[model samples]
Target: MPAFAIAAEDPATPDIAALIGQHLAEMHACSPACKVHAMPAARLAQTDVTFYAARVDGALAAVGALKALDATAGEIKSMRAADEWRGTGAGPAILAHILREARARGYRWVGLETGRHPVFGPAQRLYAAHGFRECAPFAGYVSDDFSLCMGLPLA
Candidate 1:
């Protein structure tokens, strides 16, 4: 297994964009009917947010984002780990990094939306294991049977 490094970068960076594209492709390929909608790479690259990518031996292994919602709030978005690296702790490490970054940026709360499908079970567990608790939807999202919302308070 390759060692991984997680860090932030501009979404527009060529390598970052490619990594995001690859991550999105892997997610879609794994779950074509994914309850959580996959944002197009172009749209993701245009967002004003902190994006982190996991690199193994200088190759992208995963990518995720922390979007600032307000002075004390942030939202997790587009988290994806390469299929080859899924069971190698890449996901959790990337998530932990995002949480740390959120706290560092003065965010009092961080939340995420994910599918409630079986394929998402691991992700839900990952979040729960990291101290995130199930919560009502935020950021204009309405209740949906196929979706789950989770949050963690930093304070």
Candidate 2:
């Protein structure tokens, strides 16, 4: 098996649902309630978003989505790595996969929104390691104390 493998998956899969639920709950818990921007399973299933589930050694490792923002860019939403898989690089693997997908689809950039809480420090580090640098809000999000955005240009 490869060091990291990813595949397209149904956003509504029961396993994916549980991961996303936990992600949303954690986001809401650590930040102002209205600042949580996690996408629900239903919304993740929309045509504009391509969702993925990743596994390692046959165990569910994580889930994420690449949401099309326009012809030239996409937003990564709902990134969640199962607690058991954190620090094991599963989430970053999914992020690398999302970037590959963006490149394949001719997107010049990929961006994401995460929390500003201390609890999110690791997440910030992960994105930074992948070349996702902080940027102004790109989609519907805005500048706020609790919300931060990052973008990586593919080309």
Candidate 3:
């Protein structure tokens, strides 16, 4: 297994920005234009969002972000594992980090909007393994055939 570490990161950094570009491209490829909710690097840098990066053996491997919806809820966004690290635990590491941050902030629950296509199967399974369940959309998201909304309650 690859050794990995996840930490808060500046989304606008060149390497991070490049990865986000790839993430956005993939989201667009699999979902309709209006249903692609992945945020751009500039948006991830906003104060309400906390972006994270995972590095495996000292090389960037994945990225994820948490956006505060309110004091009681947070939204997970922009999760992506580099092609080379997709099954190397990099995605899980960043996801765990984001959840820890949510708990530390006293959030009651966390949720996310993901695509409903076969290409998103792995991501859906990842969320499920971490205890997320399908739920009504949150934080201004609308119910749609192309979107899968999931949530996990924090104690």
Every candidate's CA RMSD: 2.9, 1.5, 0.9
In the predicted model 1, the residue pairs found to clash are none
Best-to-worst ranking by lDDT? 3, 2, 1
TM-scores for every predicted model: 0.83, 0.95, 0.97
Candidate 3: misplaced stretches above 4 Å? Answer: none
Better of 2 and 3 by TM-score: 3
Q: How does model 1 score by TM-score?
A: 0.83
Instruction: Rank by TM-score, highest first.
Output: 3, 2, 1
Best by TM-score: 3
Model 1 alpha-carbon drift over 4 Å, by segment: 10-35
Worst 10 residues of 3 by lDDT: 137-146
lDDT of 1: 0.79
Compared with the true structure, what per-residue lDDT tens digits does model 3 show for residues 21-102? 9999998998889999999999999999999999866788999999999999999999999898888888888899999999
Worst 10 residues of 1 by lDDT: 30-39
